[model samples]
Target: MRHYFNDLPKTALTAGYWLFVAYLLLPLTLMMSMSFKDANFIAFPIQDWTLRWYAEVLQDRQFLDAIAYSAFIAFATTVCATVIGVWIALVVATEGIFGRAAIFALACLPAVVPGLINAISMRIFIRVIDLPTGTAAIILAHTVHAVPFVVIMALTRLRSMPKNLTDAARDLGADPFIAFVRVTIPYLMPALLGGMIFCVLTSIDDFVRTFFLGGYKPTLPMLIFAKVQGGMSPQINAMATIVLIATALIGLYAEYLTRRARK
Candidate 1:
């Protein structure tokens, strides 16, 4: 016998969802409020609401520098990761590649493995290889981490792609490169764009891996972590709020563009 629809729980589900949403967003909401507080101590229910902290972040040299550094690294990671990931995906999609499964597993190991362990291992490996721990090193590390995500996204699109499209293009006198550029790329653009955005954000917000790999340069997240450890400040809260808002905006824009492309 089927249970009656009236027997189903409703309020419990709503309560649980609300609790989960609060868990995900309460800290962010608190941070947003703290950013506007006019005092050093981070008290809930801000006494004064001011944009002073936001202005301070704008004027602070260290904050500006960190933002620039993070931006550079994120952009670099997105580009390198996208290029390598797409190329690897193309190789994976092609027939008769030796040890294709092995290659896929190797490429995605960074994504599935514990990042802290990976960081330590990467640090050891880089030192052995005589690679300097600087921006270049961070870029390399970020790219390696970013590539797996890129591959997963690109491969999903590539596998479902029809072979007849490429064949038809070839029959119409288009070269392999042209066919891929004109057809495959346009079709794969959404997943590729989404992956690139994810890569950039990951590289930007990353502190643990960047902490171990970075020589001296403090990326924005690293600096924020340091400030957070010292004490709570309106400035830190303000900066965090700004970053969170920026990330949200980017995600929304990317989603809009990708959805539009699909339509």
Candidate 2:
């Protein structure tokens, strides 16, 4: 009785942790299972498991186009976001340019604001600037949304880096740019890769912002939203399942980089 009482907090914490995990995982499990069912509509106790929906999704031309466009946007957003984020992180971490807190807050404004608000603001900006609204616009909007997260991740990684490495390189007569490229970039790679993964995923999954900001062209998530407006199909489930698997793989890679960086 004494032992049980002494361990009560631990028992409660363990229970709470499992409950939290279940809350997150249960829906995903159900969705994946539903994706496998050979049914026209979504339901639990899925039966007649088959891959027909996946085959259909692959065969669908519009789905393929959406996937291609989404991939392009995600790749572009990752590049822009990571590059800009690393630059911002470097300045904020090292330079005290325009004051660190102000710079960081400016960098993070997109992330701090609600997605809908950011989308609306970008939409207005695009209209005001007379920018051709299409893939470029969507990519720019997504890049804006993704940069802050990358900056935060990069800044955290930068904090852990040896402060003297750049100084040592400079002492060895390396120019500032050369020192940054050689001494700083290698240390930042893992975090940059991690941030890129997240940025890519965010760009791919963003529907609300893309839907508002993207003109004419629809992303994969936007296409899914359009399709679901009519009715839910196993094909959508199949697409979602494929995306889920890809996300899991990328997440694993990110975890690997994070662990390797720690070493």
Candidate 3:
């Protein structure tokens, strides 16, 4: 099977890989193009462009507040998610924790479940606990969404390590903390950074959970959603273009980092 997979021509291989890349990029490109239309109607025939949506969205204090709030929540939740995810990965990969499979299954619940379902369930749960329905709820919901991804990212790093390297560190009079600091941490660096960036992206880009959890203040995605629903605007196109650029840059950087790690 390995030989058969490896036997494909390099051009065929490259094309297949780019096929996936194109699939990921196409919608973003379309969204960006649509956002820049000079007219109110979002037609696709390549007309004049304007930055009014960007100006208007930026001018609104509510939208500005949403961006700030989303940044804060995403940063905090990313930290929390990374810590928990890496810890869980370490324990499961090295410590043989009880019912590891079951634990991982539970952790993955948020990812597998529908976003609306997760948001509804979370809203009810938070209400039961008497939690506020605004930024606090958004942060908590984002954390829940981010944890499983962080775990998966960290696990890739953990499994990629050669067992012998860690064992040798331990044998050299280094305890768990010391060995991890000196050896595992450095090797898993790319995965950790990538995971955190991915978590931030997921948190900021999420609309469904944020819509239910956020009150009054809207995140950038929610703001985009609201403007999009009412009617198309040139400035909205401009904002969407900015987001598409940001996403592409992050994904490209992440891909580069992963490739560098392999090399």
Judging by TM-score against the true structure, name the best candidate.
Answer: 1
What are the per-residue Cα lDDT tens digits for candidate 1 across 142-217? 9989999999999999998899988988899889999999989988999999999999899998887898899787
Q: What range of 10 consecutive residues in model 2 has the weakest lDDT sum?
A: 94-103
Candidate 1 TM-score, true structure as reference: 0.95
Q: What local lDDT score does residue 207 receive in model 3, on the 0 to 100 scale?
A: 91
Candidates 2 and 3 compared: the better one by TM-score is 2
lDDT of 1 at 116: 91
- Scored against the true structure, residue 32 in model 3 reaches a CA lDDT of 79
| lDDT-better candidate, 2 vs 3 | 2
Give lDDT for model 1.
Answer: 0.90
Give each prediction's root-mean-square deviation over alpha carbons. 2.6, 1.9, 5.2
Tens digit per residue, CA lDDT, model 3, 100-153: 888778887888889999999999999999998998899889989989998888
Give lDDT per model, in order.
0.90, 0.89, 0.84
